[model samples]
Target chain A: MSRYVLRRVVESAVTLILATIVVFAGIRALPGDPARTLAGEESDPATLAAIRATYGLDEPLPVQYLRYVQKAATGDLGRSPRTGLPVAESIGHALPVTLQLAVFAIAIAVLMGIGTGVVAAVRRRRPAEWGANAIALLGLSVPNFWFGQMAILALAIAYPLLPASGFVSVFEDPVESFRHLLMPATVLGTGLAAIIMRQTRSAMLDALTADYVRTARAKGLSSAQVVLGHALRNSLIVVITVVGLQLGALISGAVVTEQLFVLPGFGKLTIDAVFTRDYPMIQGVVLVTATAYIVINLVVDLLYSVIDPRIRVGGPAL
Target chain B: MSLLEVQDLTVRFRTEEGPVLAVDEASFSVATREVVALVGESGCGKSVTALALTDLLPRNASVAGAIQLNGVRPSPRARGRDIAYIFQEPMTSLNPVLTVGRQIGEVLKRHQGASSRARIIELLELVGIPLPGRRIGEYPHQLSGGMRQRVMIAMAVACRPKLLVADEPTTALDVTVQAGILDVLRNLRDEIGTALLLITHDLGVVADIADRVVVMYAGRVIEQAGVHRLFAHPTHPYTRGLLDAVPTPGRPVLKEIPGRVPVMRATSDACTFADRCWRVTEQCRSVRPVLEPGPAGHPARCWHPLGGKE
Candidate 1:
């Protein structure tokens, strides 16, 4: 197990290095010049040159990349040209909001996904299963940005219950934070819920037909115990994988939903950095998002061993 | 009175090509403390008959006729408490995620409330699983195939069920392990006085453990008699064919049955085994043979019986 963990850590480090190289190269490959963007468009050539030299952009690409890697390793992402603040500080500010939204969305997705999946699989031929399947299809079909706007129109305009386009820190006021986050989190969760539900349903269908399920039934366990206790636990290995992948995706790719809801999250930060050619902020966001993706997958791998005793990492069967 | 009685039980499955009769008009009973073997070759409906006993067939399969226990029809609620089923593949029969103790304990808890941990260990010990205390915590894959089957048997007998239906229980085990599993099952029957309905394609296992043998071919019970009687003086040709097919030690040549068991059609007039039977006459081909009584009141389904003299 320790060997497994060590190997995974090494692999994650390699992935991070590769991701940094790609992000750094890709940002540089973008058409706009960061130095010219930082300086006024009408500024003299010498001023732009001075800005480029100061940021070390005038140096060769490899030297600049090495310097960027060195600075990033020490937790110093160069200052954002837009706000003149350290990119690390700005990312830190935006990360909590994105993490909170991701966490909430995933919680909602998992609960709804597993619950509906179990129900659908257990009462497979019944009307309830049909209804759950239809709901899942709708969840998968609707766009999150469109759903977010519809929620605002229905909840904020029609009902006047929530402020649809703002975020509040949960530490300051828990109730207000929940109220503000409920719509966007749910909107972001719907697609994830659908994906998770389909995977869970198919996995559960396979599990329900397993020989062990018949053994459980032959033991006089109720249908509830047979489905939930015997089958659902086995099905969760598949659902967890989907959750990890979809959760990471939501954390990094919720830019449009954030824009629709006006949440100042890392996704929003990423979009702003991209348009204004803020190299440091863009690289920092990509690095953090990629790291979160890797970490989430690693955590999921650990969870597989925990949930299934059959999965013994880095060892032959006992 | 018989502990479990199945009368005229027939199971049909509805598929895209319409219904297929898996088990047709099969009838048998297991008296108190009796080991009744339902023996047949593969695809002869032995396993389907066992599944029908516990009402565990899939949704597409429809079962007809009656299954009564202690003179009363057992409901689905009474299925596990009174009758339990062990499947062919023990590796897949035991839940991979649950500990051996938890799986056994669950049955006890459901049937007999508040099943303590001590009871789980006792059940494990009953099935000959070693180190009952430590082994109880291990998962299914941690154990060998024979050990996994022991866990399955432990779960089945946890409730002290009146009748245990084992569908080809030891077919997946190696030759050496098969004997030990059979011994454990025999011990279970002797100790608990639980009636055993052993389903198998192996005639050797039937001779070893079964008291009465019900020989099935093409989804019908073709012969039913005491195991010793049936082996000594086989009444039906199909039963004779089955007994002949078993390889004997030092035998010059093993006898082989002529053809495969044909799949049944919805409206068939011909005998199921006529195509495979050596004595396939014109009367046998055009008309189906019904199960009729033979000498000593043994039942054999054949138009021409192999009488003791023959």
Candidate 2:
């Protein structure tokens, strides 16, 4: 187990470095000069030069990347070229909001997905299964941005159930933070929830008819016991895989939902940085995202081994 | 009194092609502590009969029959407590992700309550698994085919069920493994007084372990008798064909049962096995012979059953 952990950590470290390089190059490749954008077109050459030097934009591309990497190694993410605020401090604020929203979305997705999937599988061809399937279809069909817009219109403008646009620290006010997070989280989660439901339902359908499930039934287990204990337990590997894939999609593409709700998460920060050509801030956001993806995958692999002993510790699958 | 009595059990599956009769009017019984072998080839509906005993057939199937255990209708609660099943292909039959101990523990816990770990080990040992302690933590993939079948046996007998219905239990094991499995089953029958409804197409298996034999052909019980009487007399043409198919020590050429079991779209009064029977006649073609006492002195659904004098 330790050896497997060590290997995965090392591989992730290498991938992280590669990701940083890609992001650094990608930000540089965008049209328009960061120096010009910050200094304004009316600024003289001297002002542009000064702005460039302040953010290390005047340096060669490799030197700038190396300096950025060096600073990142020491937890210094530099300053935004557009706003001149410390990138790390800005991220320190935005990261929590995005993380909280993502966590909420994932939890909601997993719970609803597995719950409805179980219902559909157990009820089978009954009306309950049809209802669950119909709901899952709607969840998958609607676009996230459209869903988020609809939610804002209904909950904020029409009903006034929540504030239309805002930011609140979960620590500062838990209820308000939840109120702010709920609509956007649900909107973001719907797509993933549908995918998970589809996967779970199919996997469970198979497990229900599996030989072991028959054995469990022959053992005099109640329907509840058979479905939950024997069938659902075996179907978890597929659900876990779906969760991992959907989670990756969530972290990387939660931008649209964040934009609709104006949640002031990394999505907003990264988008603003792109429009204004804030190279350092964009790089910082991308770094955080890449690290998160790696960690989430590692956690998923661990979960697999936990559920199925045959997959444990990189040993021969016994 | 019979431990299990199944009367006129009929199973029909509603497929896209239309309703098909899988098992028709199949009747058999197992007396307390007796071994009754339900013998047939694949698609002969023996497995359907076994599944029908527990009402475990898939949703598409409609079963009409009377099944009673100990002279009373077996409730769903009686499934694991009173009647247990050991299906074919032990590797797939046992849950792969579960430890050998936990899988057996499930039965012990469900029918009973709070199954102790020691009890699981005891069940494992009962089926002849050595080092039950070490084997407890291992998954199904870790064990050999015979060992897994033993685990299956252990699970089936966990509640000391009155009747254990095993569907081709030993058919999936090696020749060497088959004997060990039969031994475990025989021991369970002898020691615990559990009636066994053994389903198999192998006459060798029936001869080795069965006290009574029920022969099925094309979804009907063609013949049934004491194992010795059936072996010696060989009444129905289908039963004789089945017996002849088994290879003997000096028989250079083994006989084979011709043709396949037809998929019955409509259950007809016509003899279903006439197409494949050697002794088929005009009356046999036009009529479904009632399985009744005849010159052979046991029930056979054949107009001209072979004499028992041989």
Off by over 4 Å in 2: A313-318, B308-310
Most lDDT-accurate candidate: 2
Name the DockQ score for candidate 1. 0.69
| Fnat of each candidate | 0.83, 0.60
Top TM-score hit: 2
**Residue pair clashes in candidate 1:** none
lDDT (C-alpha) at residue A59 in model 1: 95
> How high is the lDDT of residue A98 in model 2?
89
CA RMSD of each candidate after superposition: 2.2, 2.0
lDDT string, candidate 1, A211-296, tens digits? 89988887879988999899999999999888887876677447877888999998889989988888888889988888888888
| DockQ values per model | 0.69, 0.59
Q: How accurate is candidate 1 locally (lDDT)?
A: 0.87
Q: Is the docking of candidate 2 incorrect, acceptable, medium or high quality?
A: medium
